[model samples]
Target: MTATKVAFTDVKWTMLVTLHMRAMDSRQAEPVLGDRFAAEAERRIDYDFGSWRMRVTEGDRHLVTLRAKRLDTWAAEFLAAHPDAVVAHLGCGLDSRWLRLAPPPTVSWFDVDLPEVVALRRELYGDAEGYRMIASSVTDPGWVEHLPTGRPLLVIAEGLLMYLTAPHVAGLLSRLTTRAPAGQVLFDAIAPWVVPTSAMLSPLLGAFRMRWALSDVREVERWGLRHRDTETLLGHHERVPSTLVRSVYGVFARVPPVRDALRAFRFDF
Candidate 1:
């Protein structure tokens, strides 16, 4: 495998933390990951050498687990509906969603991310029978042309939107929608207020960097995506306790009603 050209930074570290969180959930769901992945994930947590130290925030961890479960459910349903569907996970990082979903042999899954991230993933997980990895920035429309455009595509952007600016995200969405005639995209978003503040304070959260270039859900609709659903992820998921949600989001919760103006939003498009 080629050495990763991507430098370790807070933004990239955040993805690693999220991936570890999901791997932990997989261990909890089914011992499929067994001791190996779990132990490796634990070691990553222990070393704490990354840009952002992986702190298991109760609410954030809870939300990560809940979202993993929900994504698995959605992937299973999508596979069942379109047995031959093509699923693309944008900015996949080191996530093993394919392993978690275990979609049938007929399902074709593509894990797409930056070249460096993809290189690191290949070293860590390698490719499977029906799974492939594309090393390219999501903003590049060229990658979409390589996918099986004939089949319906289920595109997933988990915890990726907030990092990109609105125009770049909008362009990516437009390209995907146009490239794949009919498809659904599931992604998470935060209110406009959270974007600027998070961007400013991101450096403090370890090397876990964040940049919020987008604000409105309506802007996504402008790119030809229809809003399908919005749900509070952590506590509302039932999997996570309300207390945990309050604890994790409590900082945000403490924000005066004026600050409440900065609530996050999840959209299915």
Candidate 2:
């Protein structure tokens, strides 16, 4: 059946991409994340995703789960120290991350996203105590106001930041760094110079042209947060898929210029 119940708008439509990626991961021979909850959530969506062709090879598949898997790993580590840490999942799609990551019982997790996206997520996943679905853009100055205070916080931005304007992203970075003061943040992106041509090459991002892209990981240091990695997050993983991607990444990672095809950074304030 075709989707007629709702139409995804602007950045909200991007959520389906992550949902589809997770669904694809579940079907892999050796799934990276193995998020069964993601597969189930994809099933519950009435939207028809039969024609979207983003991941065309095993290499693409490995990259998809790598972003998510890294974020999940970081979350686990943060929660291990501060079992009651507040997790802010910005631009959270139909990810079921709280369900998949399974943070501690005392952990406070917030799924912050667009109004339409949050509404859809509520329908798909329902409401749970300590887990919230905040309906607002991550750029909002007051977005930080909704999160719990006086607790260790970990902000997971996953595929966000790039789509926003420079000022918007700057404002958000300032807000996050100031509001939380001390915590971790996980966000991934290609360099600004590359992002202009990225959409043309990747069929998935072809339609949605991102608004802003930063060229360097060090740029974020201006926001008072330290960039944790110089290399791409995909390369440092323990269990990289034994595909041509590994070979390509192995060689490309040797270079200083082209190594950061997709840069992942964890920030410490």
Candidate 3:
């Protein structure tokens, strides 16, 4: 007989990748890291759920997967430009971006997360020549000082901001911007209009053990970072094609009013 295992808060959430990978099935969602990473992520999710208490839905799965893939594409492009730079993935969770991007030998990649997540990452991926895992929350400024200076840096905070309070996120952005001489940050934010609604539904979602902390896109500017550009992801990628967008996203793409309102924004420093 199998013994019951206690659930821990430190375990990386698998629902994060479910949305994007499922969206890939429609052929409308163009995933930056391709299929292998998505498949691996799904496998990890399945493994974790088997051993722990977690819940995911078809919608949640699709959104998380698409968001991750989009961010992966953005991070890959940044790394490609600065081959010798340092790449930091804040709240790294159990992602395999280093494998997907395959940075050159010269590039240094750091995966930052809570201590528990770091332990899990070590257990799963081990260490490599240039890949390092730092067990520290991004809000902690001490980690920034340790990173190598004198080169462009690319910091990625996929699905991180939403979980943070406004002040904490602002503080983190300020610290990162000040520390890196030249670098860009790629992150997602919801518009102000969507936050209240999301918050209202949070309780119901929480009943199922799912909760969301969303951020307003406009609030990012308060961090003193330059606003670059914001792209609406639903049908933005050319590779994804229109048919897949319509089929996978369904009414999400068709409802002009809702599509306009519920869009993700990208910001830079």
Predicted model with the maximum lDDT: 2
lDDT assessment of candidate 3: 0.62
Model 2 misplaced stretches (Cα beyond 4 Å):
1-6, 52-59, 199-206, 234-245, 255-257
Ranking by lDDT: 2, 1, 3
RMSD of 1: 4.8
Best by TM-score: 2
* Residues 62-146 of candidate 1: C-alpha lDDT, one tens digit per residue: 5665555565666677788888888889988777677767788888899999887787777767888889999998988789887
Worst 10 residues of 3 by lDDT: 2-11
Model 3 over residues 1-269: C-alpha lDDT tens digits?
22223133322443233423442443434443354654544444324442223343443444555566677777777778888988878888767778877899899899998887677667657899988999997888888877787778788887676666677877887877777777787876554455556556543244222123333445667776666656555554333434554465665656654544434555666
lDDT of 2 by residue, 1-269 (tens): 33325556545666776777778778777878887887877777777566534343223656668878877877788889988888888888778889987776798899988788888887778877778889998877787888777777888887787777778877887776666647887887776666666557555445456666667667778767887754375575445546666677677668755766577778887
- Each prediction's total of clashing residue pairs, residues at least 3 apart in sequence or on different chains, is 6, 0, 6
Native-to-model Cα distance after best TM-score fit, residue 11 in candidate 3, in Å: 8.7
lDDT of each: 0.64, 0.74, 0.62
Q: What is the TM-score of each candidate against the true structure?
A: 0.77, 0.86, 0.76
Error of 3 at 86 (Å): 1.1
Q: Cα deviation in Å at residue 269, candidate 1?
A: 7.0
